[model samples]
Target chain A: MLFLIEDAINGILMGSIYGLTALGLTVIFGVLKVINFAHGSLLMVSMYAAYWTVALTGWHPYLALVIVAPAMFVFGYYLQDIVIKPIFKAEQDVREPITVIIVTTGVWYILDNLTLLLFGPQYRTLQDNPLRGRMLEIGQMLISVPKLWGFAAAVLTASGLYLFFQKTRLGRAVRATSLDRQAASLMGINQYKVYNIAFGIGTATAGIAAVTLVPFYNVFPTVGVLFDIKGFIIVVLGGLGSIGGALLGGIIIGLIESVGPQFMTATWTEAIVYGLFLLVLFVKPSGLFGVRYDW
Target chain B: MTRRHYNKMAAAIVLILAFGLPLVVRSATYLHILVLLYFYAYLTTSWNLVGGFAGVLPLGHAAFVGIGAYTSTILYLQYGISPWIGMLVGGVLASFVGVLIGLPTFKMRGAYFALATLAFAEGIRVMVENIDRLGPFVLNGPRGLQIPPLKLGLGNLVFASKEPYYYIILLMLLAVLALTWVIARSKLGYYLNAGGEEPDAAMALGVNVARSKLTAMAMSSFLTALAGAFYAQFTLYIHPKSVISLDLSFEIAFIALIGGRGSIAGPVLGALLLRPVSDFSRIYFGDTLPGLHLVIFGVVLILVMIFQPRGLQEPLTRAYNRLLDRLAPGQTKELGT
Candidate 1:
């Protein structure tokens, strides 16, 4: 019973972080209406950025977010502006351009392999960091301190994003474009600029997720591929564009991964997750938290 | 001479050249490369049935390939069944699975369908990697299954030389291309083209879009599996990472896109162009730069999508027609009308 409780707690904490990782994907999908296959690569890139920032500066892992977030934002903004915008312009008539998906996949390949070329595929963990291997003990229960921090960070980031989207002028512009790009454009909103900003915000959140992960996880070039697929499943489960749905959906998956090994092999947990995803897709293609009408 | 006569003559000449090249270029290394080239062309052409005609990106075709390779390999290793028979079993099984998956996923839009298939494939791979045995069969998990080059004959499908493999793949490629040509002029082809462009319109016209898409998926999966079985026999190895990889799936899609999806000659053109680039790049920089080829693939995919979304086939086809016209002085139809 105690072990079950321990696993559940671990699941919740880790699941929230997974939700945080997927939050950017949902946000980008909400606005851009493209899957952004490179989203995982972005997370991988940000993890590397965070890893280096702490490695070089000897600061707390979370502190690297200060540099990584802004840099990632800029990277994403320009990536949309330069590489993806041309395709979007050409296929302006398509509600969701299939070409953009291919382009993003191309980006995924480039970013991952380029990192392999530059970093040589070695797994790096933050050394001499304040959060390294810290654990919280509470009488027959041990919880990872980094994961607890990650949980808090996830909640804070989620709330911040919600408020940003609901209250700010830029946020409203983004919402307007997402709702109806043509109408938003007629009302004088720069649709392309909104896409760039939404992409930036999404990348920034991935950077934040990277900071949380760098403390507890090993950083590597292909690390994003693992999370990328997980993020897709999570976003789909939570409702593609729903913020809270992403969190809850992530928790469900996290719970499966965390608690499933008690009954089956660790690999079986992955199958269970996939099976559940397929079930949801068949039974409720709109996702658990998604609106009935297609986005 | 009429354009039909010229086209027939040109096809015969190309066929003659293809069959005779192995005799001229006797190097084993080049023959091996050419065999692989034909293998990819065959795979890409099979992929085009659904990816091109049906216009849905099924990113998990490698799963079918994996299925074909594993089924045949297991049957051969354990039951002493010929891989030739095993290939058919795998193809039938793959088609059934394909139809089952397509039933639910075919209704999904582009991104969702792609993701679902990807998850499905990944799920299968993980399962294969985890389970070392199922019932009486030995999967060996991540260790993979290797076929010993024990028997060398037509019946065993194992050969000592590359020429046999080369001719087999080349014939397979030609046969698949011919099938594609036939399908392009068939009722199913028109239905797929119509459904791809406008699903609602096609449905309104009573086109049975869902059934047509499912049919394409079934055929595509079956053909893809045949290639997979061929791969297992040719390489004498079958592994999850090598056979059931997302990269293989993506490469198949890339060939279709680069050569031109929905067109008969597109996959061949794409395979012809891309296989050489990937193969040569791997040869030169594989050890030193490990992933340089993939980077080049990514760059090429991006450049092609951005500049020539329809693929190289469109321009190449036009250029071919122009050349034909120049040769026969107005015998050919107008180019790109």
Candidate 2:
């Protein structure tokens, strides 16, 4: 029972960051209809930003979030407006929508390689931080203090985004655009602004997630590739455009990743994870909680 | 001269260049680049057979390529088979695996299909890296295979220098290009083109969409695997990480796309265009900025996406034809008249 509880807790902790990493990707996909393959790289860059800020100024990792989050948000906002906008403007045949996937792939290569050039191949870590070795125990359950922050960040941001969509005008407009771009535009929504903001907020989640996660995973150029692929699986599992689905999918994947090795050898970890991705894809392409792609 | 005469002249010039340039350019390094250029041309052109003509967007082709590489290498290392024979065995293996990947995936289209294929490719990477329990023979997994240096000869397909490789890869590329030409003019090309253009319509017309796609995948897989086998022999190493990497898949796809996929010469043009850029960048700026070449390539991709997302092949051919028209407007029509 104790081991089970411990595994579940660990799974949930890992799931939080995964969920957070996926939120932006889901949001961007929701409105832009472009699968931003570069999202993982965005998170990677943000983690590095947090790392460098702290490394240079001796600031706490969490304190670096304010600088990094907004920067990432802006970067995503402009990327959609500048590069992606023109592609959308091209004729369907002349500019294949699939080209956007290629374009994001290009962006991914640029960002990943640019970082490698700047940062070299070394993994950057948060050293001498108070989050290190800090843990909370609750009756045989041990949780790292920083990980608790990760869970909190995931929960808070999720709820925050939910409420934003529920209450705010911009959020509803964003949702409306996602539901149907033409219909929403007819209702007089500035389609581009909504897309830009959706993209920005979506990308900002990576920053928040990175801040929470840097304490656990080291900052590296290729780190985003891991999360990006994981985040992609989670997004697909949750449903293409569903935010809550991403969270649910992430937790489910986390649980599997955490407890799967107990039943099998470590070699099967990826097979297990990717197998689940295929399973979900085959069984419920719409995802567990997501509605069928009506639009 | 007529268009046929122009084509013959162009062919003659191209043939002379392909064979003669190596003789003139004695630098082994230059020949090495030319060899790699043709190799990529082979892989990407084969990839375009399925990706461009069939429009399946198979992002997992690296899986087939890697399978071919490892299959041939294992056959050579473990069973004492020559790579020449092993390449054929590898091609057959990749075709089988390609069908497996295509059977379920051909039902899907676009990004979903791309994702499934990517999953299979990544899955292969994971599977190969964990073969420790397979026994005493070191397939090397992630550490990669280091083949014992073989005797330099035609039978072994191992040469002491770059000259033979240049001719071999160039011949292989010409063979693939010929294959592409035949396909373009044949019934299979029409089936693939029809299936790509309108799957439902093709099925309605009795063009077996699934079969067409499966056929393309088989050919594509076989050709790509041959390239992989070639790479393993030339590099004298086989790492799943390098051979089957996602980066290589993306590179193949981009080369095809940027060169204008679906056309016979598109992948060839793509490989030729990017090879020099990559080599130049690596030579000049690679030391100062480890990834400057890819950065430039990335920028080029973005620019291509913006300007000519339709790709450069059509535009390039048009420009070439226009130049011919301007230089000798009467010559092209004079022969027929």
Candidate 3:
């Protein structure tokens, strides 16, 4: 029973991390209608950013989030403006999506290699926080405090985003565009501006998540690929374009990963998660919360 | 401009290159590079059946390749089954697995299909790493499998020299090219192209879009698996990391894209150009900078996408046609029908 509890706690913690990663991907997909294959790379970049900030400035890793988040947001906004806008402006055909995919994949490769160039493929961890060693004990179960903090932060961020989308004009513009870009344009909302904001916010979320999770996971170039895959799974599972679905999907995948290893080997954990994804896809092609789009 | 004229010219050129090149370049290093080039070209061309022609964009093709390598090597080592026969079994198995993945995922649109394929590929890699026991057989976890030499022969498909491997891969490439050409002109190709252009319209036209994609996937998987078997025989070692890595899948996709997807000539050109760059990079710069070659390669890929997304082949063709016009200005009486 204790073991099960521990696994559940561990699973929830990991799920929080997955949720944070998926949040950025889901936002980008929702607003831009382009899957940013480079989102993971951005997360990787942010992790390095946080690592370097701590290494150079001697700031607390958590405090470095303030610096990295806005920087990532600006970087993401300009990146979309410069790289992604041309593809979107192109005539829609069989090749448009392919062009976007290739461009972003190119960016992914560049960022990955750049990380290798900058960091020399060595693993870096932040040693500033004593919380890295702290854990919370509840009923014979031990849970790391960093994870609890991560979960709290993820919930706060998700809630903040929910409120923003529900209440703010910009948020409504984002929603309107996601629902129908042409319709939103007809409403006098600048679709391109909304895309810029959405992309910025999306990348910023990844940056925030990176800083939060860096204390626990080591920073590396390839680290983003694994998280990116997991984020993709979450985005799909939660039903693309559904923020609420991303949270639910993250928790479910977390539980599966946590409990799966007990029944099978940990290495097979990913397979089982993917098997579940395939199962969900087979049962509901639209995903748990996906609405069928006419396009 | 007739099909017959083009075929004759192509056949004559291929024959000349095949028969004459071996005589001219007797160096073992060049032969080794040729063998590697042919191997990758065969794999990339096979990948084009699904990714290029059908437009499925499988980012996890390396999973099938890994499966083929592991299956053939394991069969050869444990049961003493000749690799020639083992390769067939492995190819069939990979095809079956491809069909399984395709049946469910093919129902979705482009992005979803790509994501599903990527997940499936990564899942296989993870599973291979964790599988502890299979009756009396063990996968050796992450360490991989190694096969001993079993004498060179047609039955064994093992080669004693780089020359034999080179010939074998050349034959494989020719076979794949011919097969791709046939498929490109068939009714199935029509369905694939239609689905790739517009899935909903294809469905409205009474084409089983999912089924067509699955067929292309199965064919591609089988060919990739066969190549994997050939690879294992040549290298005499197989590892999940080596065979099923995301890098391998990306390389396959990159080659197809760079050469020009949806063209028979694309994968060939892509592999021919890119593989040498990769090999040369590894040979020279790899030891000094670790990942510098990849960084440069990434930059080149970016530049290619930004400037010439149609790939090098289209621009080259355009330039060549312009050159022909320049050289034979009076003879060019309306270049095309």
Using lDDT, give the best candidate's number. Answer: 1
Interface RMSD of 2: 2.2
The CA-based lDDT of model 2 is what?
0.83
lDDT-wise, the better of 2 and 3 is 2
Regions more than 4 Å wrong, model 1: A293-295, B332-337
**Model 1 chain B weakest lDDT span, ten residues long:** B328-337
Q: Where is model 3 more than 4 Å wrong at Cα?
A: A93-96, A289-295, B1-11, B136-138, B326-337
List of clashing residue pairs for candidate 2: none
TM-score of 3: 0.94
For candidate 3 chain A, the 10 contiguous residues with the lowest summed lDDT are A90-99
For candidate 3, write residues B261-333 as lDDT tens digits. 8888878888888888888877887766566656665666666766777677788767655665665555534
Error of 2 at A32 (Å): 2.2
Best-fitting candidate, scored by TM-score: 1
In candidate 1, what are the lDDT values of residues B212-313, reduced to their tens digit?
999999999999999999999999988999999988999998888888888888888898898988888899988889788889889988999988898888
Question: What is the lDDT for B237 in model 2?
Answer: 86
Q: Lowest summed-lDDT stretch of 10 residues in model 2 chain A?
A: A89-98
Q: Tell me the docking grade of candidate 3.
A: medium
lDDT of 1 by residue, A90-208 (tens): 98878888888889999999999999999998889887678888989978988989999999989999999999999999999999999999999999999999999999999999999
Residue A257, model 1, lDDT: 94
User: Model 2, range B117-174, lDDT digits (tens) per residue?
Assistant: 8887888888788774366555666788866766667766778888888888889899
The collision pairs in model 3 are none
